[model samples]
Target: MAKTVLITGTSSGIGLAAAVGAARAGWHAVATMRDTGRADALLEAAREAGVADRVQVKRLDVTDAASVATCVSEVVAEHGHLDAIVNNAGAGFVGTIEQHGMEQVRSVMEVNFFGVVELTRVALPHLRASGGRVITVTSIGGVVGQPFNESYCAAKFAVEGFMESLAPVAASTGVQVAVVEPGAVTSEFVNNVRLDVPAMLAQAGPYAPALRGYVDHALKSFGSDNAQTSEQAAAPVVDALTADRMPFRIQTSDWARDFVAVKLTDLDGSAVQTEMTGWLG
Candidate 1:
């Protein structure tokens, strides 16, 4: 039987790539985006990849509980069983902590963190029945905080913490939970981030030139000048699902690998803390 995998946020980026990758690997891919009306490109990509027959596009809005329930139900009904779900829907929000209101931060978390939690909660029963896996896309920023992106980092951290807690419980149930932390990958992510700050707090201001420099440096450091595209970054994630041995976490890029290695191997925590201070500033 072809394994059935449902993925969220497939309108573009890693989600779309993962869906196509799964289909190419002989799995049934139920791909979803916030609005199916805008998914012509995703469909076209699937067709170009020669996996259109195995890809099913659906409407899904992770922040909406009703939408999550309806989409999951529809996928399960169509596929009979869901072998995996990749929670790949999220965006970045950039602004100083004081300039960006808590409301804006909450909105970020609603979609990036709480939304995935809700979806996983609703999909648990079906997943447990089929002994499936839950894979979430986090970022290096989640493990190490950064300036001007507190909300985005917070949401990813929340996701990391949530999945870490769930992993132990799922171990006993034969269900697996893991996270993919990618450094940068070429996608629409940068163009999509919301910048909520007053003109007075503009990054380009003379008074805040130092702050502006730091922010620019971090953004550039996200991925290589010639970083992997969404399709390339999807390889490790797809590997995680089909691998003979499951890993609790997978970092998709070389930068991500080095960052996570330093994060995990830093027994003193001093080196990592030093690296984090620059971003926190």
Candidate 2:
């Protein structure tokens, strides 16, 4: 029998690509999103790839505890067993701590950090039963903080620390855990942040010039040719699902690998701070 893998945030970007890729690889892909109404793109892509039969759509709001529990329970009950879970559902927030309110910061943590924790907590029992793995799509920001992305980076950093600490413990129980960090990828994720540059700069007050500088830098970075496509970034996720040995940390592209390396080797953390300082002009 083919194995099953459940993935969150399948409406678009890396999540959509990974869900389709997993189905093509012969795993029953439970492609989930907060709103199932947006699954058309995923289903169409899967159909074009000839993996529609292997891809199933489900509703999963990662930020909701009950939603997490119900989705995992229903998957196991219907599929008999779940071999893997890819926690790719996430949102992005772009602002300095002074610019955004505490509620906004907490909202970021709710989706990016707490959501991953809740889903993993709910899935661990079934994963242990099947000796399966947990794959989370964190970001390079998780390793190295970026300018104007305080809340986003903080949430991702929490996820990296959580998964890093959980890996060995999960292994002791016959389950594996890994975090996939991707640099800037061409995806709806950026657009979904809904950054109104002019309005934000106007409201930034003391932080306006720095905010403007950071926005310019970010636009150039995302528009650069070095940016990975969603599909390219999702490839590592599918690989981790089937690999004989998945590392505790996985970078999706060479760019991502080199980017994160700066932090790993920065003994005093000066290198990363200096590099990020450039973003603020």
Candidate 3:
């Protein structure tokens, strides 16, 4: 029997690419999104890739507990078992601390952090039963905090901590847990990020100049050649699921690895702060 993997946020970006990649690699791909109505791109891509027959588009709202349960249940019901799960259903927010209201901050955490927790929590049982894997599509932001990415980075940081804690415990039972961190991927992600620059600058008031400069720099960095295509970014997520040697953490690119390493190797924590200060200011 062929293996099966359910991936979230498959309407676009790395999630869509991963779903199609898995199908191409011989896994039954349950490609899910919040709105199945917007699955045209994934379906079209799958058809072009000759993997449409193995791709199934479903609706999954990871932030909703009932929706999460139903989606997992339905996938298992259709496939008899779930061999793996790709927690790729998340959005990004970019703003300074007070630039965002408490509700907006909570909203980011709900989707980016709690959604990963909810889906992974619900799917762990099925994964355990099948001796499966969990691959979360986190950003390099998870490994380090950046200016203007306060809330988004915070949420990803929470996810990194959560998954890291679970990895060792899960391994004893034959289940693998890992996170695939992508830096700037060339996808709808930049366009879709919840960033109201004007509003942020307005709310920023005192910090406006610095925040504006940082946003400009971040945009330029994102548009650079360093940005991985969605297909390229998804490769690590696919590997995290199918590779024989399961790694606890994997990044999509060397740039991402170096960007994250600054924080990880910052034992004194001053170097990263000094570097970020230069960029932010």
Greater-TM-score candidate between 2 and 3: 2
Each candidate: what lDDT?
A: 0.82, 0.93, 0.89
Give one digit per residue, the lDDT tens place, for model 2 in 81-183: 9999999999998888876789999999999999999999999999999999999999999999998888999999999999999999999999999999999
Where is model 2 more than 4 Å wrong at Cα?
187-189
TM-score of each: 0.91, 0.98, 0.97
- Output candidate 3 Cα RMSD: 1.3
- Name the TM-score of candidate 2: 0.98
List per-candidate RMSD values in Å: 2.5, 0.9, 1.3
The backbone clash count of each candidate, in order, is 0, 0, 0
**Candidate with maximal TM-score:** 2
Q: Write the per-residue lDDT of candidate 3 for residues 79-114, one digit (tens) a residue.
A: 899999999998887777765678988999999999
In terms of TM-score, which candidate is stronger, 1 or 2?
2
Worst 10 residues of 2 by lDDT: 184-193
lDDT winner between 2 and 3, please give it: 2
Q: Which stretches of candidate 3 lie over 4 Å from their true place?
A: 187-189, 194-196
At residue 12, give the lDDT of candidate 1.
Answer: 81
